[model samples]
Target: MTDFTHMELELEAILHASNDNIIVTDDKGIVLRAIKNSEEFYGEPSEKMIGKSVYELEKMNVFSPSVTRKVLEEKGEVRLLQKTASGKTVMAKGIPVFNSDQQIVRVISLSHDLTEIQQLKEEYEKLQSKVERYESEIEKLKKRETPLDELKTKSPIMRKAQETLKRVANSEATVILFGESGVGKTLFARAIHRESDRHLQPFIDVNCGAIPASLAESELFGYEAGSFTGASQKGRMGLIESADGGTLFLDEIGELSLDIQVKLLKVLQEKEITKIGAVSSRKVNFRLIAATNQDLKKKVQEGTFREDLYYRLHVIPVEIPPLRERKEDLPMLSERFLHQFNSKYGKQTTLHPETLAKCLAYSWPGNVRELENVMERLVIMSDQPVISPQLLLLDSSQTDEPQPWMGIESFDHQGKTLKEVVLEIEQNWLLRAVKEGRSTYEMAKKLGTSQPTVVRRLKQLQSDSK
Candidate 1:
């Protein structure tokens, strides 16, 4: 082919590749060729319309107000919106191609359908509306908030556990709380549920160990009416179904039987459950938080716990530090519980410094729960305003865990001579004896000295200040 013909083909190829829908027709409005996209724009492929007339296409209601006819009549370019048979709209442009005679030989047409862009705009508006609605709901949820101050911790290990809870509170991820018993795993689970979007819904907390092994399956998965002996007349919803649109906390989940573990795994995988005698399953949805004081991985290895179920519950493992590891929080926790009990029982009880010292010295075998019971006992049983040190050791002898006892320092030796330190210790000992209402004879007997010597030494120490 000649260079002019080659350049012409190249130009046509560039026009066809352009984003615009280009159609070429003779001056008589007979369709000769059209770009590929024009078929989607008009609902008819270019090959089928190669020899068709634009007049017949208009009569067939393909598109109204033909731009090709306007270009022929006015002998110039025409651009306007055309209505399609699908009730959608398009922008069409037509230009007359003339030869050396200045008379029109062909009409070049380009059009674009606005339906897709319009649909996208509409969808964008709908998405914006949904976002606004959710933001408003979150704001309302923030107003009716749970007592998160209970979760405020002092130790670094406990802080890390709180962070994990906050991050997963708004999601559907399963969380497993690992810690010793009485470390507040149940409290953490409830906090997560209250802080979540499903706060308004029920929070079903089930303790696998608390329920008997004989009734465990029926209690968790429910039973149909008359399904077994002594069954309820009407079927009851189990803990799993009762937590729909909320949260499910399975405390001591490690204690569940292997048979129940397999069924629980199926419920998690399918998000549905069938009653004991029911053929069809009913759907349920809830966030799951599992807690265990036992070694679950060991159970998995021993075939007591299902491996699949362990992995499902182990999605986000948060280990809460036992109270022994975070002993620094003991003082604050003790004060809070003291005030709590004082207000609860309408008593004006205060913790004695000696009592607090003994509490700090002993390792918390039962963790926060033990402290709570201890404080409540002090408040209710104490007759005086200040609790006595004698009562603090009520049940320390029978505790399950060993007590790595710590003793309070008598005095600090910084910037002090040995004689001064000894004198200070003697004064402190005498003052403690006075606070305990011990006479000189009792003090002398304990220190292996005479009563007159104790009286004379106490008088000398008192006179040294003057």
Candidate 2:
């Protein structure tokens, strides 16, 4: 074969091998050739498409607003979206080929089916809308007049705690909040920080129990670069250092090891922090707000916690009473949570009189956090505008009795195995526990298993449900 003919054949092979649908047209927008993929995208065979004018094709609606015509009009590269005769969407890019004279000779059109991309784009838009709505709600929540503005109460005990919080908010004295888990200790800490002079500064929270014992020190007191194996190339700033010129609220402070307790005491006393693997200490001016559900005095007596640290943190002690102790606040707290969740889920739901009565009567072991969770669940799960008392998932204020079965009943097993049935029951149990404000550690303790196992099971249950 002639060399020019061989080169032409090679070009044809290259065009055919390309994944993109390719069409080449003369400067006048008349198709000269089209690849096999053109039929898949444009619903027209290559042979039939050749020698056809793109303008004519446009008139026939073979492809709307032809990319070839666009490139010809612009005398340059053009990219556009087009709908094929079969109604499939495609993204097309047309590039003009120029000869030595700098005049347009041919136009090469490359297109890819946009059906999947369009679907993905639509899905992304929906997800983005949801994220934006959630963020807007979060911003509204943050801009509230006061963090404790939502802590509506009539109880003297809660009022006393609030009084103490307000009295010491501006003071630099270390404050310790002693309460049961879910009693809104963190909320009180945030309220204090917001009311303090450092309200404009950051409020850094560190969960001592959440971090592993091995990495607790490094996480609290950041290390320098190459301080240990697997350290970040840039030196890390510890949580304490990050809270400089702000307030550092350490939740579950009793979980800290004795060694960490000693270093923390130094920080409280000296108003400075020494990072791990560093010689010199850096001065950090931050107010400390430590909280714990455990009795630090008992922990110190048991030698699990240091006496000096206890004394240092116990300067302005605030005890937040649990929900069961202050049942008068239940109605207000429940109403607030209901409104919040209703706004979140785009629902207008209300508690039935009986449902409200049931909620008031229950001895909530999980406190305010649990009540919030229960309200959210009711908002999401209830079909009626007025939620009923029958919808209450928790047992009747009796902790000794087994939890009532709330799942769908399968009488004949429906051809399911025992394992599947057992798994469904277990998953339901775990979900209810989580909705009751039970953390992984709390769930593990109740289940007599490890925290990691509870987490894994919960994750598996979530995945299966999804």
Candidate 3:
């Protein structure tokens, strides 16, 4: 075969082997040859396009705004996004064949379907949107989650109170904490302030009961220079002014006199406060969190506490349950306090089960404060590594009388002999040992007997009981 014939055959073979649609057209855009891939790509047969001009094919909508037309007009390589009536898309690149005279002779157009690339791009966008949505949800959940790392609460009631505290933390609403004395109401108020938008600002804590009634007004609302005989010449900013843009935790609110209550109600209503001798009132913006152990409702009926002030401060009421009702949290609480006091006092003291049992059995009238104080005392005074029941020192009355919880169950003889009664007592003590996982030496120490004797009696008792 001649060189020209061989080249023509090689061109035909390459066009057939190509996966893309290839078309060779003259300078006027008359189709000379085309690979027959139109049926799959654009729902048109390439055989029907071989003899037609690209201008006629463009009118037939074979490929709108043809790449061949662009190459012919521009006289250079060009690319176009070619689409058909069947919604098929392809990226077509058109290159003009240059003659020896630097003139365009032919236009070679190659196109590949863009369906896969389009689908991949759409999938990437969808995945990115989902990732952003999930991140936003995770951040919201983190904000809602309890700060259990510092303040542990196992009771549902206490946890619900914490949830309420989180919900109203950012708003400028007044929160009133109702609970018995030593129920950690002050701590919850601090938590509310810590989680609020004004966390970086000051948290002014005031115990209304601790302050003397004579100076309560001047202490809360500040005083001007020479406002009183003993007042400083430079004047003073009280707790209310000092807590601007932050939180003012009024602890023991029930202790405030009726006169101070009226002034506080006016402050809550107007959002401003006046000094003792200042003519103009200064605007104050503070989040109020009041705590009281006294029954304010009864106080109001008795004409001691102001009813209007009660309603203002009672916007969000969160009651903290006393420790007695939440004894299930005792183990965690005691362990935490034990660990804390041990670290503080440079001691490695551990709480024994029997010692904890004494704590659990006692009615903690003073609540968590009492429990905390007891633990602190144990850590400081107890010399041994393990704290025993004798070292509990719970109450003076407890020392005087026998606690029923600490003693064994009382059983009737039921006409049985003394020997059977003594055997039953032994069984009760052994049962306690089993539950406690006590070693023979430990049992002997408790029983004031030898280890071998205790071991022999344990085996004999097990056989007799069976």
Could you report the Cα RMSD, in angstroms, for every candidate shown?
Answer: 17.6, 22.8, 21.4
Q: Say which prediction, candidate 1 or candidate 3, comes out ahead on lDDT.
A: 3
Candidate 2 regions exceeding 4 Å error are: 1-145, 397-466
Give per-residue CA lDDT, model 2, range 212-232, as digits (tens): 999998999999988999998
Candidate 3 error regions (>4 Å): 1-149, 396-466
lDDT of candidate 1 over 24-82, digit per residue (tens): 89989999878866667787777877889888888887778789988988999999988
**Model 2 accuracy (lDDT, Cα):** 0.81
Question: Which pairs, if any, clash in model 1?
Answer: none
- For candidate 1, the 10 contiguous residues with the lowest summed lDDT are 399-408
Best by lDDT: 2
Write the candidate numbers in order of decreasing lDDT. 2, 3, 1
lDDT by candidate, in order shown: 0.78, 0.81, 0.78
lDDT of 3 at 42: 57
Candidate 1, overall lDDT?
Answer: 0.78
Between candidates 1 and 2, the one scoring higher on TM-score is: 2
